[model samples]
Target: MTPDEYAAALDAERSARNDRARYVVCEEHGAHALMRRNGSGQAWGVARHVSQETAELAAAFLNRLKEDEA
Candidate 1:
């Protein structure tokens, strides 16, 4: 799937959750890594790894998607 599509899917899943949470996407070793963040903006754990492009897309869309969901 394309990076934007992947990011949309992730945002949808995150929006479906019952609690307020956030995620940070980063590039690691030529791959994308997702890190879960708590309400206080602290990193909790790494969730998954995706493509570098996907990570870039996700980072770009994260805030916009959250605002849209709100």
Candidate 2:
């Protein structure tokens, strides 16, 4: 997905949880963001550069390794 589309989705998700939350799209990383809150609340965002295919593959391999260790 394009950076703008991903950023929009992120913003929507954050805003849904808290309207006061602040979100800014990271220009250097298309899939990342800088998020914060005004008060003593949690500061959080996402790093989403990895493709779904890679994530799935990594999860599968990690599960297999865990099984072997057990």
Candidate 3:
């Protein structure tokens, strides 16, 4: 990779661990859930919801790294 591409890749990896959430869809269950990236780079479920808004709200809270807590 070029210098810029390598830097961008590193930044993306850092963001995924620090402050990122995924909107997971469970088609089998017909529901959506908020999945947060854990310290160990695993998918951690925060909450499940039938609506998009609620799931996103939960993701917002779980994804942020509080300055006080950090």
lDDT: which is higher, 2 or 3? Answer: 3
Q: What TM-score does model 1 achieve against the real structure?
A: 0.40
Query: How many clashing residue pairs, candidate 3?
Result: 0
Which model scores highest in TM-score?
Answer: 3
lDDT of each: 0.65, 0.48, 0.59
- Model 1, 1-70: lDDT tens digits are 9999999998787666524666678666666777666666677535445576666566557756765775
What order do candidates take by lDDT, descending? Answer: 1, 3, 2
In candidate 3, which residue ranges exceed 4 Å CA deviation? 1-28, 39-41, 65-68
Instruction: List the candidate 2 regions with Cα displacement exceeding 4 Å.
Output: 1-49
Candidate with best lDDT: 1
Candidate 1 achieves a global lDDT of: 0.65
Error of 1 at 35 (Å): 2.0
Query: What are the per-model numbers of colliding residue pairs?
Result: 0, 0, 0
